[model samples]
Target: MADRSGNNKKKVNQGATLKKVFERLGKYRIFLIFSILLATVSVALTLYIPKLTGHAVDFIVSRGNVDFPGVLRVMVQIGICTLVTALAQWLMNVCNNKMTYQIVRDIRNEAFHKIEILPLKYIDGHAYGEVVSRVIADVDQFSDGLLMGFTQLFTGVATILGTFCFMLSVNVKITVVVVLITPLSFFVANFIAKRTFSMFKIQSETRGEQTGLIDEMIGNQKVVQVFGRGEDVTERFDEINERLNRASLRATFFSSITNPSTRFINSLVYTGVGITGAFAVVRGSLTVGQLSSFLSYANQYTKPFNEISGVVTEFQNAIACAQRVFELIEEEPQIPEPEQAVVLKDIDGNVKIEDVSFSYVPEQKLIEDFNLDVKPGQKIAIVGPTGCGKTTLINLLMRFYDVTGGQIKVENIDIREVTRKSLRAGYGMVLQDTWLKTGTIRENITMGRPDATEEEIIEAAKASHIHSYISRLPKGYDTWITEDGGGLSQGQKQLLCIARVMLCRPPMLILDEATSSIDTRTELKIQQAFAKLMEGRTTFIVAHRLSTIREADVILVMKDGKVIEQGNHESLLEQGGFYRHLYESQFAH
Candidate 1:
C-alpha cells in the first residue's frame, strides 16, 4: 500500500538534466550501437540453452531409455552457447566503460570551464563547498552510478523482452500468468523512486552544505581560533551532518525496499507457473520436458523484473545528483563579450565616468548618478566608509558587473566597446587581500606576465622591495608558496602581489590599500617602490591612511557611493569638508 501510494504522482527520469546527459553520450552513438548488438547476441544465446536442455530431457524420457549420445549432443550445444554468450557479454561491458568514462570526462571539463566564466555574483552567493561538491563529488557519483545503472537498464529490459518472446513460443498460457504480474514490479519501483527523488536531492544539498561548512571552518580556522569559537563551529557542523545523515538514510531505505518486494512478487509468479504447468502435464496437454522448460523460462523471463526494480531505485539518486550539476553548468555566464570589440592598444589613460549608476540588488541602490574624470597619468584617490561602494566602483570598472546606468569611457571610447580581457589587461591591480596559488615565489610573481625574463622578474621583485628577502630563502625564487601562501608573513605575500603588478607595468593602476600589510620601515621602502611603479600611469588609490594619498593630483571623499568632497590635499583641508574631518580623525594627536 505504501509503495502504491508512493507511485501516484511519480515522475522519474528527470527530463531536462537527463536529456543533457544523453546528448553528451550521443557523441559515442557508434559505441552504443555495438554494445546493444552484443547484448542482443548474449541474451539470445543464453535463452536458447533452456530450450536445448528441455529437448535433451524429452529425448531420453519419452523413449524410457538412455540416449547418452543424443543428450550429450544437446549438452554440447548448450556449452557452445554459454561460451559465445560470455564473450559477447565481456565485449558489451568494455564498450559501456569506454562510453561512460569519455562522457564523464566531457562533463567534468565543461563543469570546470563553466566555473571560469560564471559571474562573480554566483560565486559570492553560494558556499564555496556547495559549488565544489557539484563539480567534484556529485559529478563523480553521477558518472559511476549512471554507468552501472544505464547498462543494467538497457540489458535488463532487453533480456526481459527476449525472455518473454522465447517463453511465449514455449507455452502461451503460462507466459500470460508471468506477463500479468510483471507490472507490479514496475509499479513498486516507480513509486519508491519518485518518493526518494526529492530526498536524494536534499541529501545532495545537505552534503554540499556540510562540505561547505568544513571548507569554511578549515579555511578560516585561524580566525575561528582567535575568536575562540571552536565549540560553536563544531555545533554548526554537527547539525549539518545530522541533517545529511537523515536525508541519506531515508533516501537509501525507501529505494532499497523496492528490490526485495519486487522479487517476492516474481517468486509468487514462479509458483503460479509451476502449479499451472503441473496441471497441463497431468491432463496430457504438456510433456515432462515441456514442464521443465516452462519453469526454467519463467525464471528467465521474470529475473529482469527484479533487476529493473533495483536499477530504477538506485538511479534516482544519480538523477538527483546530475540535476544539481546541470543546474550549475546551465547558469547564465557573465554577459557575453561584444561581437566587434575595439582593440585596446596604446591606451592614453584618460577615463571618464559619466552619470554611472549601479546596484547589486534592485531594491538596494549602492551607487547613484556618480561621475568622475581623470586626465592622462593622474592619481585619483577614493576614500569612504566600508559599505559605501568603494569596491563596487572597481567591480564596475573591471566589468565584473555592468553598470545599471550611464557610461564609463577610456580615451573617449566607452569601455563596453572593448573586449573584457583586453580592458582588464590595461590595468594592474594589488588588492588588500592577496591571492597566491601553490607554486614558487617566481611563478606567483610572474603570473601576470609569464614571459618575463629572469632579469625582468628580479627587477620587479627589487622594485617591490622583496628581492633581498627572496635571496635569503633556500631555493630563492623557487621556494614554494603553498595554500594561503604558507610559511610567509602577510607583508611577504603583499610584496609578492605588488611585484606581480610591477612586472606587468600596465597603463593604469588600482591599489586598494596595497601597502597595508607593510611595517612602518618597510612601508617607506614600498611607498618608494610604488612611486616607481605608478610613474607615468593613471592610478586609482583606495586608501584609509590619509598620508598615502596627500600628494595625489585629486582626492575624492565619498559617502554613500557619491563624492561629497574633491580637491588636492591642501585645497580639501582648506575647504574643511568630509575629507578634512576624516583626515583629522585619523591624525588627531
Candidate 2:
C-alpha cells in the first residue's frame, strides 16, 4: 500500500519552492533578461508579418488591376520579418538552454554538499537509494520540466500578447471576440492543472520509493538469494510499481485533458473571429485584406493559448520536483564546528570516558553513567553480546556520536572542544564492513597517507598479508577495483582496509572485527602484524572472537551496556564469571 497518510499535508510550501527557483534564476538574470528580450523581438516581428500580409492583399485591389511592385515590396518585407523572427527565436532558445542547465548544476552541487554535512542519524534513518534518487532522478525530472517551460511557456505568453495588440489595431470588434474566448481556455487549463499537481507529486514520490527499493535489492541480491526472498521482494516491488503506475496514469490523464480542451476553446476563438470579421467586411467597416489579417491574428492569438495551457501542466510537475530537490538542499545539517576549536597535534593517546550517558532514543535508555579510563599505549579490548553497545562505545570514542551526558576527553582535552578533523585524524579505524572507491589497489592503500613512498605502500600491504594476492594480479598494485571491490572476495576487501590503517599508523587504532573475514591462517598472520602495529599505540579492539583478544592489556566484558567484568584473559578465566562462560562456550562447540 502507498504511504497515503500525509497526502493532504504538503511536504513543501509551493510558494517557497518557486521563490527559491526564481532566486536561483536571478543569479543569471542577464541571460534570462536577454532571452525574454529576444522572445519579444521574435514575437513582435512574427506578429508584424500578418499586417504586412494584409498590406500585400490590399495591393491586389482587383485581380489584374494588381500593383505587382507594391505586392512584391510587402512580400520582401514579410520575408525579411520571417528570417529575423527565426534568428531571434534561435538565440532565445540558446539562452534558455544555457540558463536552465546552469540552474540544475547549482542545485545538484548544493544537494551533494548538504548530504556531506548532514548528521549521521539523518542518513541512518533514510534509505540510501531514496537520497540518491532525489539528487539524481528528481533533479533530472526537474530539469526536463524546466527546459520545456523555458522553451515554450515564455514565447507562448508573449505571442498571445503580441497577437492581441495586432488584432486590436485591425478591428476592435474582432479583437474583443478573440479576448472573450481566451479566458475559457485559461479556465479549462487551470481546472485540469490544479488536479494534476497532487497526482504528479504522488507520482514523483512513488518513483523515488521504486528507485530506492531497486537499489537496496540489487546491492544485496546475494543475501536475498541465500534467504530465498526473491518472490517476497518481487511482490513488494510490484506493489510499489503498481502504485507508481496508478499515480502516473492519473496525472497523465488529467494533464492530458488540458491540451485538447484548450485547443477546442482556441478553435472556437478562431471561428468567432472569422464570423465577426465577415460581417464587418460586408458592412464596409473592414476591407477583405483587413478581414484576412484579423483571421491570421485570431489563429496566432488562440494558438498560444493552447501552447500555454500545455506548458502549465509541465510547470506543475516541475514545481513538485523542485520541492523535493529544495527539501534535500535544506535538510538540517550537522551542528557547526566551533570557531577557535583546538586542533589536536602531537597527541599522547590517553582517553578518559567520564560519567557518560547515551541512548539512540531518549525514551529508551541504552548506556548510562558509563566510565572508563585508559593510559597511553594500553590495549583495551571490548567484548560484549549483541546490543551491548560495543560499536556504540567505539562511535563515542571516535566522536561520531557525542555522549548525551558528561564528556569524553583525548589527552585530557574535551573532544567537543577540539576540531573533529584533527581529532579523528589521530586514530586509525578498520571495520569489518570494507569500502573501497573505484581506483587502483595502490590508491586504496595510500588513501590515508597519499604521500607515502612506494616502499611504504608495499610494506603496509605486506604487513596486512595482502601483498601476495595483490602481486599475483595482472596489474599488481595498479589493478583497478570498484567501489564495492568487484571481483574481490570479502576477506580481500577487509585486508585492503587493514592495509589502509596500517599505512596511516596513527597514535590510536580501532579494529572492530577487522580480521572477521579472513581465514584462520591469514587471521593469525594479520594478528602477528597487528601485535607489532599495536606496540606503544593505544588500541581499542571490538571483537566477538574471544581467542583474538587474549593478549589485550585489559579486557572489558560488557552486558546490557555496562561492563560486567574488567580484567585480563587469565584473571577473567580464574574468576569464572560471564567472561569465562562466553570464552568457554566458543571452545565447547
Candidate 3:
C-alpha cells in the first residue's frame, strides 16, 4: 500500500511538472518550432559526418587510391551542410534567448502587479524577504532553464534518434549490442537526477528562508544592538548558513556523479561495439569499410547519449524551479477585484458603518458589532488601546479588506457596490509609517496628481506647513530625496505625507497617529496644519493623545472590538466612563 501511494505521488508530481513546463512554453510556440527545426538540422549534419567518413574509407579501399576529386567533393558538401547548420543553430539560440527574456519580463511584471493588488492579510502572512526571493531567485532559475536546459533537451533527443537510425543502417547486430546497455544507463541517470532534484528543491527553499532572515535582521539592526542580541543573531544565522552549505554540497555531489557515470557507460558501450564489429568482420559478414563506419557510428551514438544525460539533469533542475514559480503564480489572493464593478462619482464623503465585524483570522475577532456615523464635514475621533482595531476600521473604510459582516456606506452607496479605485479616490490618508520614494520634494508631493501645477503643489505644501522648510533647502522644491526619504527627519517625512494628502484634496481624510512620531513643538505645528486641512472635510482621527481628540464633534471609545462609550468630548467626560477614565489616566501624567 505504501509503495502504491508513493508511486501515485510520483506520477502526480511528474504530471504537474510537465504541465507547468508546457504552460510556460505555450507563450513561445513560434520560438520552440524554430528551435526544433534547427535541432533537426544540427542532428542531420552530425549523422552525415559519419556517412561522409564512410564514403572516404570506401573510396580509399575499393580504388586502392586516394580519389582526391571525390574526397574533395564530399568535403565541400559537408562544409556547406556544416555552415547551414551552424547558421540555423545560431538563429535558434537567438530566438530561445529572446523567448527566455520576454517570458521572464512578463512573469516579473505579473508578480509585481499581484503583489501591489494583494490584500493586506496576504502581505502580512508572508515575509518580505521570501516575497523578494520569489521575484529574484526563482524567476531567474526559470529564465536560465528556459534559455539553456530547454534547448539542450530537444537538441539532445534529436541527435540521439538521428545517430540511432544511422547506426542501425550500418550494422543491425552491432546496433543491438549497443542498445542493450541503454536501459542501465538510463536507470542510473534517472536515479542521480532524482537525488539531485530533491537536493536542489531543498536548496531553493532554504535560500528563500535565509534571505527572509537576513532582511529581517537588517531591518531591525537597531533592535538587535539595543537588546545586545548580535551574538545570538550571529549564531542563528550560522545555523541557516550551515544548512545551506549542506544542501548545496548534496546537490552538487549528486549532479557531479551524473556526467562521469554516463561517460563510463558510453566507454563500456564503445568497447563492446568495437569487439562485436571485429567479430562480425572476421566472420565474413562485414568489410573493412563497414567495420570502420560501424566504429564511427558507435562513437557518434554515444555522444548523443552523453549529451542527453547532461540535458536530462539540467531539465530536472529547471523543473524544480518551475514548481516553485508556479506555486506563487497559482496562489489566489484573499481579495480580488470584482468584474464590471460600478465606479463611484462625485462623492460627498458622508460615511457610515453599521454592525461591521472583522478579523484577520476567523476565530480571533478584532472588531464586532461596531457602528459609526459621520455626517459630511464632521470631525470624528476613534480612541482605543493598541490592537483595539482602530487601523482595521480604516482598512475596511479604504476597502483594503472587505468587512466580514455588515455594511459600510460612502455617500449613501454601499462601498462594495463601487469599484475599489473609485472608493479609495474619495479619501486621503496620512499613515504613521510615511513612505517617500527617491525624488524631488515636488515630485513626492505631486505623485498622486502629477498634473497638478507648481503653484498648486506649493499651496498644498504650505497648507501642510512643509513649504517653508522645503524652500530653505539648497535645491528648494527640487531637492532630491533618497529612498524612504532618508535625508529627512521623521517629523519632516510625516509633514511630506500630509502635504501629499493635501494635494489629493479628497473629501474624506484619515489621520492615523499622524503626529505620534513628532516632538511636542513639531506636533503643535502639525496640529495647526491639521486644523486648516480638516476644515470642510469629513475627517477621522485616531490618536492615543487625549488633547488631539478633545475638540472632536463625536468621540467613540472602544475596547475589545466593541464601542463601549460614545459621545461628544464634554459629554463623555461628564459620564466618567471608559473615555473619561482614559483621558484622566493619559493626561494625569
Candidate 4:
C-alpha cells in the first residue's frame, strides 16, 4: 500500500510539472510552429546523409574502380546536406531565442501586475528580493527549459526515428543490435534526471531564502548599525549560503554525470554496432556499403541521444523554476475586485461604518462590532493606544482589506459594490510614513492628477504650506529627489505628501499621524494647512497626540478593538470616561 501510494504521488507530481511547462509554452505558439519546421528540415537532412553515402559506396564498389565523377557527386551531395542542416540549426536557434524572450517578458508583466493589486497582508510576509527572484530567476528557468529542452527533444526524437528507418532498410539484423541499447540508456538517463531534479529543487528553495535574507539586511542596514548586529546578520546569511552551496554542488554533480554516462553508452553502442556489422558482412548477409551506411545511422542516432540527456537535465531544472512561478500565480488574492461593480461618481463622502468586525486572522479579531457615522464636511477623530486597530480601521476604510463582518458604506452604498478604483478615488490620504518616489517636488504633488494645470499644482502646494519651501530650492519644483527622497527632511517629505493629497481634491480625507515626525514649528504650519484643507471635506484623523484632535467635532476613544467612548472633546472629558483619561495623560504633559 505504501509503495503504491508513493508511485501515485510521483505520477501526480510529474503530471503537474508537465502541465505547468505546457501552459508557459502555450503563450508562444508561433515560435513553437517555426521551431517544429526547422527541426523537421534538420532531421530530414540528417536522415538523407547515410542514404547518399551508401549510394556513393555502392557505386564505387560496383564500378570496381575509383570513379572520380561518382566520388565528386557524393562529396557535393554530402556538402549540400551539411549546409541544409546548418541553416535549419540556425533558424531553430533564432526561433528558440525569440520564444524564450517573449515568454519571460509576459511572465514578468503578469507577475508585476499581480503584485500591484496584492494586499499589504500578502506583502508583509514576503521579502522584496524573493519577489524579485520569482519574477526574474524563476521565469528565466521556465523559458530556458521550454526553448532549449523542447527543441532538443523534438530534434532528438526525429533523428532517432529517421535513423532507425534508414538503418532497417540497409540491414534489419544489424539494426536490431543498434536499437537494443536505446531502452537501457533511456532508463539510466531518467534515473539520473530524477536524482538531479531533487537536488535542483532544494537549490532553488535555498537560493530564494538567501535572496530574501539579503534584501532584509539591505533594507534594515540602518537598524543593524544602530544595534551593532552586523556580525549576527553575517553569520545568519553564511548559514543560508552554505546550504545553497551544498545543494548546488549536489545538483551539478548529478547533472554532470548524465552527459558522460550517456557518451560512454554511445561509445559502447558504436563498438558493438561496428563488430556486429563486420560479422554480418563476413557472413555475406550485408555488403560493405550497407555496413558503412548502418554505422553512419548508428552514430547519428546516438549523437542526439547524448545531446538529449543534457537537455533533459536542463529541462528538470526549468521544471523546478516553473513550480515556484506557478505556485505564486495560483495563490488566491486576499481581496478580489467585485464583479459588475458600480463606478462611484461625484462622491459626497458621507462615510458610515455599521457594526463592522475585522481581523487579520480568524482567531485574533482586530475590530468588533465597531460602528460610526460621519456627515459630509464633518471632522471625526480616532484616538487609541498603539495596536488598538487604528491603522487597521483606515486600511479597511480604504478597501485595502475587506471587513470580516458587516458593511462600510460611502454615499449610502456598500463599499464592496463599488469598483476599487472609483472607491479609492473619492478619498485622499497622508500616511504616517511618507514615501516619495524618485522625482521632482512638482512631479510628486501632481502625481495624483497628472492632467492638473501648473497653476492648480502650485495652488495645492500653497494649500499644504510647502510652496515657499519648494521655491527656496535652487531648481524650485523641478529639483529632483533621490529614491525615497533622501535629500529632504522628514517634515519636508510629509509636507510633500500633504501637497500630493491636496492636488487630488477628494471629497473625503484621511490624515494618519500626519504631524508625528514634523518639528513643532513645521507642525503648526501643517496643522493650519490641514484645518484649511478639511473645511468642506469629510475628514478622519488618527492622532497619537491629544492636542491635535482637540478641535474635532467627535472623538471616538477605543481600546482593544471596541469603541469605549464617543463624544466631543469637552463632552467626553465631562463624562470622565476612557477619552478623559487619555486626554489627561497625553495633554497634561
Q: Which has the greatest TM-score?
A: 2
Worst 10 residues of 3 by lDDT: 56-65
What C-alpha lDDT, on a 0 to 100 scale, does residue 514 get in candidate 2?
Answer: 95
**Model 2: pairs clashing at backbone N, Cα or C within 3 Å:** none
Q: What TM-score does each of the candidates earn?
A: 0.95, 0.97, 0.94, 0.93
Put down candidate 3 lDDT per residue, 345-462, tens digits, no spaces: 8777799999999988898988998888889889999998888888888899998888999999988788888788888888889999988988888889988899999889998888
Local distance difference test, per candidate? 0.88, 0.90, 0.83, 0.86
- What residue runs in model 4 are displaced by over 4 Å at the alpha carbon? 1-7, 54-65, 284-290, 472-476, 587-589
What's the ranking of the predictions by lDDT, best on top? Answer: 2, 1, 4, 3
Q: Write the per-residue lDDT of candidate 4 for residues 326-365, one digit (tens) a residue.
A: 6676666656656888899988779899999999889987
Error of 1 at 10 (Å): 8.7
On the 0 to 100 scale, the lDDT of residue 554 in model 4 is 87
What's the best-to-worst order under TM-score? 2, 1, 3, 4
Using TM-score as the yardstick, the better of models 2 and 3 is 2
Q: Global lDDT for candidate 4?
A: 0.86
Q: Residue pairs in steric clash, candidate 3?
A: none
TM-score of 1: 0.95
Least accurate 10 contiguous residues by lDDT in model 2: 1-10
Please give the TM-score that candidate 3 achieves against the real structure: 0.94
What is the C-alpha lDDT profile of model 1 across 1-589, one tens digit per residue?
8876554434443776778888998999998999999989988898888889889888885455868899999999999999999999899999999998898888888888999999989999999998999988898878777778757777787888898998888788988988897788788878787788889889988999998999898899999999999999999988998999999999999988988998898898899999999998999988888888888888877788777777776777788888888888889998887798887999878999999999989999889989999998999998988888888898888888889999999888888888888899999999999899998998999998999999999999999889999999999999987859998999999999999998999999999999999998989988888888778899999999999998899888888988888899999999988888888999999
